[model samples]
Target: MAKTDQAKADKKRQQDKERQRAKRQRDAEKNSSLGIREYRVTLSQTEADALTDLCAYRGGVEPYGAAEFIATLIRRDKQRMEDEKAHLGTCDFCGEPLPTGCKNGLGIPRLKGVEKCFYTRDEKKLRL
Candidate 1:
């Protein structure tokens, strides 16, 4: 009975190790192609306050809570952009050239690298 218990413990340890290894591999692959950003700026107190207010007004979010909210917003936006790119490989409607994504008709802001489609009736393709 002791030997069987030991065997089970070893199997669990091996499985844990395998899971950790796979996780590390996935992380490495994801980070391998990631880009690094660098920038520098100096702001006076008044300028900072004004900027904060502007960002809040423009983003419809509070500047004081920005750090946490921005992280989540950025992550969500990145995922949304990736999903959009995947879906727009071709036009979502009429199977025409996406050129980019169809604007349909909503006045959505265009992201960099996106092309405006000219042939779709999708509301998402408006104002192209």
Candidate 2:
């Protein structure tokens, strides 16, 4: 069943709230290991007002998420990475040309016959 736009916005709002909570918790912890460092950005009154106005102005089919915009930022960042990778025909994480026919990491000819993809070096690493 297709969800209505209001429902989608609600879901996104809930997701944003959860992400904001997690970010806040991580940012509040002292020397936390979540790798989510909180940056203290001080803005003048006018600058703050301008940012608020911008957020309100830039809102789409959902509520203005203020500084806790998760979907927009993540989607934009992913799109940027994909665009760059496509343009260069290489992995964004590792600046190397993609394989011609190799499906997985098989040591590409450029890497001296070393086949490494986006996950070859990252998938096996310790991930929490």
Candidate 3:
């Protein structure tokens, strides 16, 4: 009886160690770039279907499926923003070099959701 109890205890310990090891592996993978996460967004059924369809259009911009395509598209947009900074707008109140430069007169007049540009103290004082 004593021997059987000891064996059961050993088995439980081994199982626990294996579970911990697997958990660590999962955590490491999540921290890596290739890790996966859940993202929720609202869309009409038609839009959802369109997105699923678009995923097949390319050989898949990435190694994964539709999620990767969405990620790639987001990355592409951000890259385009940085690369095409000349097209951005500047802050009217601050006169700072806006993200993508200014558009229209006085450069957008300070938008709520727009990315702001960096301007020197002198630029702010210019009143331009």
lDDT (Cα atoms) of all candidates against the true structure? 0.59, 0.60, 0.64
Per-residue lDDT of candidate 2, residues 1-128 (tens digit): 35788899999999999999998776678446655555567889997887677677777655466556545666778887676557545554456554232233554333333445444543333222
Tell me, by TM-score, which candidate is best.
3
| lDDT digits (tens) for residues 13-54 of candidate 1 | 999999999998877777676853323557799977876776
How does residue 118 of candidate 1 score in lDDT? 38
Determine which window of 10 residues in candidate 2 has minimal summed lDDT: 119-128
**lDDT winner among the candidates?**
3
What TM-score does candidate 2 get on C-alpha atoms? 0.34
**Residue ranges of candidate 3 with Cα displaced over 4 Å:** 1-29, 32-37, 60-64, 86-95, 100-128
Local distance difference test, candidate 2 = 0.60
lDDT accuracy of residue 23 in candidate 1: 100
Error of 3 at 87 (Å): 5.1
Listed in order, each prediction's TM-score against the native is 0.29, 0.34, 0.44
Model 2 misplaced regions, further than 4 Å:
1-34, 44-46, 60-62, 89-128
User: Candidate 3 at residue 65, lDDT?
Assistant: 78
